[model samples]
Target: MINKIRLAIRNDLEASAETRQFGSGWISGFLALVASIAGLLLLLSQRYPQWFSMKELALIHNQTIFSFVIQSILVIAFLLALINLVLRRNKILGFSAITLVFASLLIGQLIDPQEQYIANAYALGFDWFVLNLLLTGLLFIPLEKLFGRLTDQPLFRSEWREDLFYFLISSVLVQIISFLSLSPSMFILETTGSWSGFRLLVAEQPLVLQVLEIMLLTDFVQYWFHRLFHEIPFLWRFHAVHHSAQKMDWLAGSRMHIVEIVGLRGLTIIPMFVLGFNQQALSIYILLVYLNATFVHANLRFNVEWLKPFIVTPRFHHWHHGIEKEAINVNYSIHFPWLDKLFGTYYMPPHQWPKGYGIGGHPVPNGYWKQFLYPFQKKKKTK
Candidate 1:
């Protein structure tokens, strides 16, 4: 059965590749240039601090030079390999562009000209980067694989322009909202008070016990937030944009509406605000969410019948995304199987998988702005 599933996946990927024409070498060259520039910046920063002004160095300090370099290398490599399976689509370019932005931010964070080597010492440290990388890989890759499988249908395939625009608009909107909502107290609340309770609760607990408590509490909050989107009509309009995706991949996870992201993150922040989770626990939770959410939506096929009843698996969440009559409004839990089981939203048959997955009723707009304004517009009947 596993071999057959693998064969099916391979065939699907091949079909997708045949339909999509990618510019592999062009992407590789672009990434190579980024890598070279990153390398040069790192070298120059280390070699000639005297040449740069104090402000210039401070700007550089905030940017993560090494992380950018590593990111560029990974992106370039991924694009080269990606062209073999997918079209020379904007999705790959979009990833590269976003990575570049993030890299720039990391660089800025690292290159404190005033502090110089001190900034570099802290900025380029291997420990945090390694932890982040491991966490990201563990969470996103598997989810990407699951999304791939769920989105086997051609209609679900993503359009680059639409996605890129949506992401940009959503991010900007969220930032604006955050700014408007900000105050001195709020700012302090956001940074300092966010995770205080969690820390105090688990301060005396063993490391392993703390980790378990953190995961349980975090997942409990996420599960309800997810279900609320479905149960609440107004919120569903915004979240339906995410469900509109007919196809799923790593980028599928990125297709969320801006408002949805803000709302979800806002809700998640409450626990941090009230509970007082430390930086380390919060970091671990972030890592777990990134990996678990991505893994559940990824294209990888693995059967874990024994584990299914305990922890949420790809098969479990895939069923949530499933388009079948029975699958809709079920499997609301994000990480734990018991949440769904306890709530009675779980719906996996003994020997069945969903034929497809997507929002059944809505005809969501394709462009970012269109979707952003979609909820505001009167609902039109989907064909």
Candidate 2:
């Protein structure tokens, strides 16, 4: 049954978007599948909070509103699936979605919201995954459809599953990633306890000023690290996985090597952590980073030439992923385009996008696990 569901999705993904007409039931069926899966995942997290829920997200899901949301989603999924079954000759998507919704309903009966268990050494971040997916997908999907740079590009573009998998693992392992990324900063703070007076002074500054300072500091650190990954051969092996994306979309940025993720977070966050930015400032900065990262990588068609000199835009970052010869080793800054201009690495052709994306020869193999092990594998010689 599981294999059947997987095959159904794979088939749908491979199907041409042109064939999936409005009244043909494909859209409703696909949405039904998503709703069912999301509903089930949230229900599982509620049932086994210790293993599937993040402690930080407790407040977000604890309210009665969340319960109402889950119920509404399940109901919507069931109705959509029924509509698909009535309209389409293929029953696969409809049947599969309905089955999952039924499974979620059965498990919902066993859930005890009051029951609590202490979290073990490790737990999945299901709550985080669901929320992240809902928020980003909701915001970007419609915008992309309406104003995408590549207007014809389908939602399930080539290699989308791989990027989505990257999104899944990164979110589900958020706890592990956060701990690994933040431990060094935590240690530095403890060891430099004498610097508390200085840190306190920095933290006492206006919240707006602190956030601006954080943006500059973190961008400066990330700029050099970003260049090093491109220049250093060993590091390029891992970073190449990110560049291997042939298509640019909101989800494409999620295709990063885990090693790079940890290293970047660990190194760039030192100033924010050790310098004692207040918790509120740090939180706001984190939120900004999340939104900015998504925005820069999104497939939007907005004209932002006015802001190009001061800030990074989709066209600016797309050049970094361009496979053209001149595109090599340029545009290393993430937030401030001026950093690249100052360091003489800036290259953005006025009113022009990349001819194509991905590595020149496409050395990096496809899929998540393959790319994960790619950096460790020895490269083959070609005469």
Candidate 3:
């Protein structure tokens, strides 16, 4: 049994390794394997919601049929890929693929699925989790393929699993983060978002102006917090987890220390509380931040040339991640580059990109838990 577990882990490692080179055949096989596992696990997730998050499942349209179709298509794809891999004598991948099927079957039998859906307020919706994974993969995977700036960077880049763990944790604990981040502020401020005076002022402004005001106010607060993370040695340890991604991609941004996430978000929203932005305006800003942050971290090369000065683009942010000494401590603005320019920290080189990414000498330990605990670990004493 021990040997079998070892073999399974070994094959998965081999399959993961092979995915980095990403040959057409390997890509198809890998996709098939992933689809199968995702599909089956999703099916089983209904029976065992505790195994993974499904909080958003209730929100999906035509949940049951949609799931069945997703699973069926993926299972078919997996079988085809399995046949292809087996014929080609790709044992490691074949082993991994087959293992997923068996494990899914075993788990399905073990769990007694409910006769009807029981809505638990706090249940992790596996359906939601699976759908989120599928949507992001489908959306960004294609974009990275067709328009990547770092063209040679593979779908399965180094430390992908580590970052993936971070992604999963953040997504699963999303509500928790919201509660935690907002709770302290809510407690202290106790300012009902209805400051009638500020609300009237906000109402008087054009909708566009309200949005611009919130963006400006929020970005101003975030800029200083972002800079604090960089400038303070203690905070740098936490922020460095984000910079540890040697390769930048859509998933890279999710690799944040929980402290940084909670602290930054908690603090950023203070202005919102004080200024009393309308619910609609706040919602718009949240939506914009969600998409913009992801786009800035993505592998795609496309950045609007004209907007580089006024807005934050992938190029604008990638330079911030650059390992180059000159680029370090530069480009601290999250939304507008003009803040960086205003602060005298802006350092964009004309007609050039960073030679590489990540901290120069400080290498972060790979994996979620290690990095999470790293900020608190004592520094090694060198005699």
Candidate 4:
């Protein structure tokens, strides 16, 4: 009831504008507003029920009533705090941000009943989705603004919508992606059901050692996979979609070929399975993989000076994506730059960055759907 009344009063906040000013302040407020709306919609999708079906939820199963109540309180508190920020800073929205949130919640509630729903498992995790979005937005937006390589680049650049679509689609299809990535492991387990004893050696090692070993092994195993995508003519067609992103940012890494994701992830996990790391180590590696992948592709101008000789960084990976003829086939390793150096594929220069990016002559199409269908279409002279 309180939410309904608030939305009614806040409807005026949505005044359409023919034009509006844009600046750091506007960007900050927009981020906060979007995050608030995302968090609220996720909350309502559950509290109201019927918003998400039972089968759609994949993260936590059998959510308790207390858990649901606590979650709702946290989301509401977070939204209220955004209003507090606005008032304290005299932001564009003032208390209107909170009212808009309330309005959204009210409309969402009206679409269904208010009765709470709980489940043991398979509950749609719109909650975690919103949290992840807010956390990444808060963390990376500042990093990019302060240290981004392309200082003059607008936050909203060319292909931004395409990358955003890729990010959202990947998030929504995470479950399917996970299952497909596990296909190789499942196949190996099925074929060699009796050889499970080998994994014990890996499992017996200390957890830290296990993680270290997996890291090195993946760098070695996946190196060839990365290189193969470049050397193989047919495969390069699919991988080109990833490099097609002319602009680089935290979100840029998510623009990947669906086939590339399934194949590459599936192949990379084989080492973990064959070597047999414990569940904890495997989970940590997965988290690190995600963070590192995003970080290396980010637009931030981070200088890892002395560490350049050891591991991959934004400078290292960006070179790989450079359109320069000399760097067209270099820097294939994802984790250790040393692997590239040893194999003779490493390409870097003294305090220099790529002047351009993307395929030199081949122009890829726009939009996520178009790019997805691009590899199948025959194009003359793919280089």
Relative to the unseen true structure, what is the C-alpha lDDT of residue 85 in candidate 3, on a scale of 0 to 100? 71
Say which prediction, candidate 1 or candidate 2, comes out ahead on TM-score. Answer: 2
Cα error of candidate 1 at position 381, Å: 9.0
Q: Estimate the TM-score of every prediction.
A: 0.62, 0.95, 0.82, 0.79
Instruction: Name every residue pair that clashes in candidate 4.
Output: 57-123, 57-124, 61-120, 61-121, 62-119, 62-120, 62-121, 63-119
Q: Order the candidate numbers by TM-score, best to worst.
A: 2, 3, 4, 1
**Candidate 1 vs 4: which has more lDDT:** 4
Tens-digit lDDT track of model 3 for 141-238: 89998999888787767767777778777766665677778876687556564566765786677777778888898889899999988888788888
Q: Assess each prediction's global lDDT (C-alpha) against the native.
A: 0.56, 0.88, 0.73, 0.71
lDDT (C-alpha) at residue 338 in model 3: 99
C-alpha lDDT of residue 302 in model 1: 52
Clashing pairs in 3: 53-125, 53-126, 54-124, 54-125, 54-126, 55-125
Q: Any idea what lDDT model 4 has?
A: 0.71
The alpha-carbon RMSD values of the candidates against the true structure, listed in the order shown, are 10.3, 2.0, 4.0, 6.2
2 or 3, greater by TM-score: 2
Task: List residue ranges in candidate 3 displaced over 4 A.
Answer: 1-24, 49-51, 54-56, 59-63, 101-125, 193-197, 200-210, 272-283, 379-383
> Model 4: residues >4 Å from true position, as ranges?
1-25, 44-104, 107-128
**In model 1, where do residues sit more than 4 Å from their true spots?**
1-157, 164-201, 380-383
Better of 3 and 4 by lDDT: 3
